[model samples]
Target: MASARKRKAAAQAAAQGAGGGVLAVKARYDAAGSGRRMRGWNPPTSGPNRAITGLQKIRDRARDAGRNDWSGESSTQHWTTNLIGIGIVPRLRRIKSKNRKQELNDLWDAWVSQADADGVLNFYGLQTLAVRSWLESGEVFARLRPRQIDAPLAVPLQVQLIEADFVPLLDADYWPGMPAGNTIRQGIERNKYGRRVAYWMYRDHPGDGQLSSAIDASRLLRVPADQVLHMFEPKRPGQLRGVSSLAPILARLRNVADFDDNVLERQKLANLFTVFITRTMPGGVDGDFDPLTNLPVDWGNDGLPLAGLEPGMSQELDPGQDVKFSAPPDAGTAYPDYMRTQHLGTAAGQGLPYELFSGDIKEVSDRTLRVIINEFRRFAEQRQWQIVIPMLCQPIRDAWVDAGVLSGAISVEEANDAKRVEWAPHGWQYIHPVQDVQGKKLEVDAGFRSRSSVIAERGDDPEQVDAERAADKERDEELGLFTAPIQPDPNRSDGDSSGESSPGRRPDSNKAKK
Candidate 1:
């Protein structure tokens, strides 16, 4: 503690301070009692007082660095690999309604089937690539193109998928020039109502710096909102660009991976076994003699020849003259424990069971696995309905309808009214098939679920199932094939004193023959 004299000296020194000179600080209990603790922070309110926020404040750094990071790419790629498993293709089916017209429904169904077969939805392998781009770069672009009349597309529309790297035509002058109606934010142009009007896509991929590239135009193409579909999961209420799913898991995953690498390196170095040789003779050397230097050395009553370390086998030596071996310290506890803990923590990001990620299911019971997977499936279903459905399937459906109408294949009224369809995503295979089938059968029998709904849940269209059955039956009848043979009643074979017969066969069959 400083005395009063010290405080007075510090105050006097502060008073006598020169202009632009450093001030001496006195260490005390409450030296900063002169309002150093701030109450509330007030941000700047400069700029336009318009209804919409000034765009300059919300500008973010470019996403290139984030996407290119090793850890970021790995986590995103891992999640994408699982989420986009075998590609989530469309299974267009009509949703029956009370006011539904059979002819209109059939028209929609036929158009979808024909368009699917014609490869209208096959936009540069849109099933996998688009999903991968969306997951990796936080968004993807789908631009509608005129279908070639001579091409196999039944509809007059086809799609071309573009990556996010090529679509965001952002520059330093993009956001700040918003009030003057100059540069657009990111690649999206918004109106006075904060509604997206159009996208500014590059004529070619920006990442392509090659001289001999087919796409060389550096100009921006203004594609209207109607013709372009931007697929991304919006994080904020007014978010323009999506943040990558890997953004959160990058550090944790990297730490785990780095830890494993360290352990592995240490283990390898410890395994590099070395051999040390020594001699045990009285007048030969002062200490342990080098065997290479003393080839004619003699051993004095010690098994120095046979008990010595081998060349390429065991390693270590405790004492040069004591004939003892040194042992390395243990590499530490079991590595699996650490890995399992880290994996369990990060597996939630993948929205899958740890067993699926690690391929380890030793402790997973049937019921437990079913519960875990069923819960995880809810996340997949939510992602499908929220992001994939609206961004991908619906846009394609609208385009398909418009194409049909433009080609005079369907009237505008029919295209608009009967265009409603149900998209069934692929279903998961059950762990226990017999139990699952029984549960489904009970659900159908108890009227809790319709047969069509049950079939649809299995990733199959009920109409297709029925049609296939009908065709098979018709073919069998045409070929005069008897599929089922008459079966004698095993329980009542001619005679049985008891109402119920023994398990295998009727006991009275021999009696009846006699």
Candidate 2:
């Protein structure tokens, strides 16, 4: 019975010990599970546990700062900062800074450099160097250094000559008091007064002077002397003995029988004279005559020689007859018959017949003489050619280049290189050589700008300048910047999954998204 009791107590103790060990193991498992659940439920608070919490705080701050909105305001800023941290932004910034510095330095250097080795800072020099650099480097910024030497563009002197001639007709020996039947002889003497009086009447009557003299001067001047030509009329009885008084009276008559015939003859004579005179004059061309013909022919189609005048030609006398004159159509309205009646009116202190004769003759004669004088003046002015000396400088070259006025380029080593080898504005083809102070040969480059080089060397920034210019253009546009609509690209795909829908096509539904 004692053995049985001891065994039973030991068995009880073993069962209790096994049960306790099992319970302890179960508690440990439950505690571990609870701790793990708690750990996952609430993030770590401190130490190594605080790492994830700190990251969460950072993310929260970023969200509050609007970094979470991809298409919102802060998106670009956020991306930029992130990119900068990765090193791209810093490198870009550095590159931009380097470029700006280099550009500035180049501009500064150009400004300091002398335009010419001679130390002359002419506008042409500045422009040439600037343009050259721009063409070579594609930059337009250049600065001009102040030149110590003062050089002004030289202005050439202009010279002209004018000539006037005085020819006296009668010598003292031909005085009216001399002899008898000589009176008839004296009246026909061709003196200065007779010629002058003849001209006066021709202007009024259009038929005076030896057809040859009238034609010669007309052809030389390239004008119609017929307008001033006068026909010879017999002088009235009791007229002054002086050639001037009587010659004028005779010139006034429109009734002179051969007036029209004389005009026709004079026209023929004038034309021949034009050809001869033009051939003798330098720079003379047919066009230099009258703007009408522009031909080198004389006034009259008739080939009259210039050498037919006798020495003693005086005014003649005959009985005067009743005269009537007609005025041209364009005569002013204020003067109904002024050109005809008044101009051809009777001479003062002369009879009715003499008066009518004097008026018509003098009027025609004066008109022709005036026309001749004017035509001569015109020819003289047109016969001149302007001579200009060009300086081989940068600014001048640039100006010519920019304007596209230069025709061709020649090297200094070439013959007559310094000359302006170009066609005239009127299309005259000619080449002019440039000469030095000592008349030595100088090489001239034909393609030159009078002003462009100067403008380029003045230190203008082409790109920035262009950009500003573009901005100005934009500002001047009719549409304001914000009001302008966006243009859609034709190649873009619409937001559709169907392959049939082209990127550029718009959706059929026009409704806005909900």
Candidate 3:
């Protein structure tokens, strides 16, 4: 027997081959009942026309199809929930300098908390909306502006989220009369080095019905790229516009949905009990009952209708008539398994775990789930850094800093570039918290991890944690509450952090005895 790797390779090779011989052999050797031949997969072969044209057409078709179908929004909704959810909102954190510049860090952190309370950042809504937009349309654009007087922050930044479709070409005639080095593709003006200089956006969304009349098509706004933060993960180097996340998997997702719906419909009908009678001795009784409800004298005895056979009441049958009462057969034992299998495929295409996609972890063990989540975390971090950080969070941070300085929430010293910031995205909930914590503790004790790193991993600021601990300690001391303070490992940082063994005690002569 061939190895699994060889079998998979052969199957892939057979699917790619253009000849029938390979397909026939593949079909015979296929492990599953169904062949691997995908529907609507006719790649052009051997010609000038085979250069893979119709990219825009493909994008348009995919978008239209996704909107028309439920799987597009439903799958995206599930992904967004799994990713951002209500608890996964990324919050801003001021990073402490390793050079031990503690005072400035403290000041910056105070300003952060104040600015957040001021609502100048609008970080909450920005993160939620940006993730949704990026997941749905594969891009989200944010325009920075000043906030209203009544806004939360004194000089808070106003972030206006824009959908990908709102921006249009200044001249529809394909980068009309531009210099050789510069080109405006899909409203994004990029220079010779492929650096985006600006974006030409419409005053209002073209699809906004209320503003459609007020919107001036000719009056395009030339916003600098710096002012307009475009968020997307580019698949190709020079690709300007974004294709929808559902674009590639739209067809497969829809097919699976339709199949599931079909199975469900059949199962519903199967559960319904239908009455069938073969009236052998009846000739004059030409009446039938309703096909669905078997109502009183609905098409009485006229026989089965041509349109459809619904479960309903039927007329009385004569004696010696053998009849079989049936509606639809059970969706069968393979129904749920088949759905799980299909959903697994869908999840793979979307780069999500089957559990996350289906929300079913009936048979998944803790170890298995952890492995799956660890893999997904990588994907999540990539999105956070590549898409959210630069395009949304960092820009918002910069604007917020300017607002803070203007509002006097942050002093000039704290407002300087030295007060670096870190955007800490929400962390994960462990499958087994106790076990996970034990492992983390061992990691810390083994000197592979730092206490601050562990706390940061749990979606918290270490500085904040330290401050809270100090406040608690003071409160406890005043109350004479002798609670054991959280003790750090003596060997941590190879014990170079402190000369004393205990971090909780002061370097006093009396406390040295304790």
Candidate 4:
């Protein structure tokens, strides 16, 4: 007892030496306190802390859910279709020399056609794959492979896509050949100042073979940081890696899917029209009863019973034997409403509108749909510009230009001039075509928005659109075709046309104008 008291005193003294005394912090937030409501509410302090322990398991489950669950697939497809669409086409910007700009643009177009190291996917297709993988696996890597100078290519640069699995989440105090004072966290090597210096990656995917041996230092390749492109949407300030977009909703998706399957099975059983035979006495049973047909069962070659129900079939029952039909409960009328509510949660978790994600428009109105779609478009635009453009597309562009300059295919001056570029993502179709076009026209006419900006928003180059328009006009002139000048809608009496009502106007509008 005296030794125990001495030990406790020593511990207290050590605590006092470190600081003034043992600090007892009481959190003011009710949620952070050890209250009844806060029971089982322990959460990690940061994103990395939460992700570091079970990242691989989370990624594997997410990929499985994406493959199996409808909601998971919907989330991936919604982002890919909206954020990527056909492709985010590039437009060279602000090149003083028109000839140089055209040449650089043409060269870039050619290089992108065969950018993939495997020669299977183009650059834009790689973008789609990267985005899909990012959603599925949380993060993806691209190795910038500089080709030989004499290689037969427009630009001597190719991109090799690497899955997140390539980089092992190996947190170590000191790895083999690691510089002093640098620590490895989640497979990334960081120097003293916390700058990522390199990545420890496997030469081949560790999960590629079933008989894969235990990973060792020899199996890891230290790749320079600049050569690899890491694409992931970071949810925390100092997150070392990404967690799958489906991670948050995976359990919910599985629960919803299981419920749906159960409901389906219940409905199927409910419609089975099964009849059960009850026997009163022993030794009175003649043959096995078929639940499906309520007829005598026959054995097959495999010793399994085969039963059939034919129309107008009659069966004889022994004495004291009676038949009762099965009346299994259906999936209730609330099933549809319950499913809709569950799907809404999944859609919100995926950052998508319910209508777009689930393809359910039974309860959607035009105005409500318009609002939902606009909000979704804003979300997609943020992802495109912030994550995809800067992380994936711009780096590839810069690498292409550098390769072109190095390979002597492009002059240094031209490469420098063509550095500025604009990547335009595909535009969405108008919800109300006529109204949308008229609104754009009004905006353009009133100088509230520029015509160039309008064209760009439609995923077209303004200069190219103008040139196409000029060509069409020239062709019409050459063919002597009468082209009417664009005018305001005859039905519109919004005071822009002297409040005049012309042909095709409503009688009430004309009367009011008169």
Relative to the unseen true structure, what is the C-alpha lDDT of residue 123 in candidate 1, on a scale of 0 to 100?
36
Per-residue lDDT of 1-514 in model 1, one digit per residue for the tens? 5698899998888767852243323443343334445324444544222212322211121143234444444445555554555555444344344334545445544544344333555432464567666765667888877676555655666667777766553532344324445446666777767677777776766558553423222456767888888888776566676655544555676687778778888777766754344545565445444454443545656756423434576434334343324455555777788778877766666555777656679878988888887887777788878998788877877787787777776577666554566766666677689998879877876789998998887777687799898797678667666454223345444765442323333333435654
**Whole-model lDDT values for every prediction:** 0.61, 0.29, 0.64, 0.84
Q: TM-score, each model?
A: 0.66, 0.14, 0.69, 0.83
Instruction: Tell me the lDDT of model 4 at 313.
Output: 83
lDDT, candidate 1, equals: 0.61
Q: What is the C-alpha RMSD of each candidate to the true structure, in Å?
A: 12.5, 54.4, 11.4, 7.6
On residues 1-514, what C-alpha lDDT tens digit does candidate 3 reach at each position? 4699899999888777757766766767444334356444555453322231443344455556557755465567766665564433333344345433455444444434433333454456456767777777767788877655455644555667787767753323244334466766667777878788878877766666455433353656777887787887677655666666766686787687788788888888776766565435346755564333333343325674433444674545345555687857777899888878877877787888878766789988988988998998888778777877777777776776676666665566656563356666776777788998989999988889898999988888787799998898678777666563455565556534343544444434225564
Which candidate order results from sorting by TM-score in descending order? Answer: 4, 3, 1, 2
Best by lDDT: 4
